[model samples]
Target: MAIILAITNSKGGVGKTTTCANLGAALSAAGKAVLLVDNDPQGDLTKVMRSDPKSLKYTLANLMNAVLDDTEPELFVNRAVIEGAGIHYIPANSKLAGVSSRLVALQMSSRYRGGETGGTPCELVMARVLELFQSQYDYILIDCGHSMDLLTINALAAAHQAIVPVQAHYLAMEDMADTLEVIQTIRQGINPKLAVGGILLTMYQGRTNLCRGIQDEIQADYGNAFTVFSSPIDFSIRVAEHPIGAASIFAYEPNNPAAKAYSAVAQEVLSYGQK
Candidate 1:
């Protein structure tokens, strides 16, 4: 049931690591089976998957301290895996930005605040890194790290969904009103199985006019909550020379036009995984 997501945007060059490395390599070139999790420590999706995540040595901070000792966390997973058409990677390091204050002080002294933290402390360590891979990938995503703390609150409490690439300037729709009021206060408290998984539009130029007036002011305000991607991603130059030239405009041109606008935003995210 892997459908995680969480591409986030508290604001930062607004391509969110090139839309999480070309929508996890365009949903693994549309065959699915992707993974991508680079919870951004400025690793830039493991340096655009060209390696040198400080020369890796098992990352995701040893899968968050072996899921805080309950262990069995994919045995500190490390594939260093590099497939081409059906993406898979967990390679994010800058030492994962010192794993958010040791996972917010070890889930703040734990009693199960959420799991390792306990009592649902905003989805404790992203639900211990999504219960060790959420039954192995079909799509996990998560490329955050623009800011909000605790690694964007454990990737929006381990996401059930979230996109927001944004960029067409003019304060990118006023910084998406504080990231949609912090995703509407994390959907009123903490993840109500989350949603808003759309709103891409990165780097667009559309022959200017303030980039089509900020895409008609982000579809005249949130466009009925969200769902904007109708192929926009522009301002190429091979996606601005891929994170210091590693690669990803779905490997430099999976049929251009910003890789077919992330393959029509990954087929509008597989039509929301068929509802």
Candidate 2:
């Protein structure tokens, strides 16, 4: 079975999509079978992996909807899984917003409340889709949106662990608390095996006093509770350009310091299976 990791944060622009793509690329380069799942409605990860999201007939939303309708997802799952930059991935688009709303509606419905629907729980809809792919890959990385909505919750419920990417800033440190709390809630109420893989400090300017201070604060606050990855992703234009360039950092700029940092992160992740 794959070690499923959700690259998530409750705050946007914290490098969730970037981590999901680059980490998968790094692992794939290391001879691991990687599957990236774009869970965000913005489809940023999909855009980075797929030349055109609209050109695809199926998506993550289709798989979720298949589970919602209690249909065989294998039909759509195969078509949705596409390869890019040496990683297989399921793309997402704005249509996922409708799926989120359906989850909300189901949560509000008495039929769902009474189990009359007799289908997977709203929070586990994505989990049902991912279960089919779990055994086929070494790692499954989910790129989540910046919210604790049903969609993000579904990702958490499905994942074995979460990799939180926080920017090296005081405010980002503050946001980390809410993200951890959500993970804890899921661990307590939904997936008991769910663990936090680590907190990754991204957009780091190690030379700056401010970045160093935030990094220290994160390590001090979260280190004892969860891992604070030793490797901090250095702030670089190359990272921000990967999605636009439609390639992972390894493909875009293998020698870039940011790529090396992600490779370090991947090493730390691989060490998890060792332990």
Across 164-197, the per-residue lDDT of candidate 2 in tens digits comes to: 9999888887788999999999999999989999
lDDT over C-alpha atoms for residue 90 of model 1? 77
Model 1: per-residue Cα lDDT over 1-275, one tens digit each: 79888888888888887888787777777788887777877687777767777778876766765665556667666453445435777777777666677766665666445445433352466666676777878888888888877787778777888888888888777776788789778867877888778888788899979988888878888888778877878888777676444457665566778888888888889889687
Against the correct fold, how does model 1 do in TM-score? 0.36
The whole-model C-alpha lDDT of candidate 2 against the native structure comes to 0.89
In model 2, pairs of residues that clash are none
lDDT of each: 0.75, 0.89
- Which segments of model 1 are wrong by more than 4 Å? 1-14, 19-37, 40-44, 47-49, 52-55, 68-90, 93-122, 126-153, 158-163, 167-182, 185-187, 191-201, 206-214, 219-234, 243-275
List, in order, the clash count of every candidate structure: 10, 0
Q: Name the top lDDT candidate.
A: 2
TM-score of each: 0.36, 0.96
User: What C-alpha lDDT does candidate 1 achieve relative to the native structure?
Assistant: 0.75
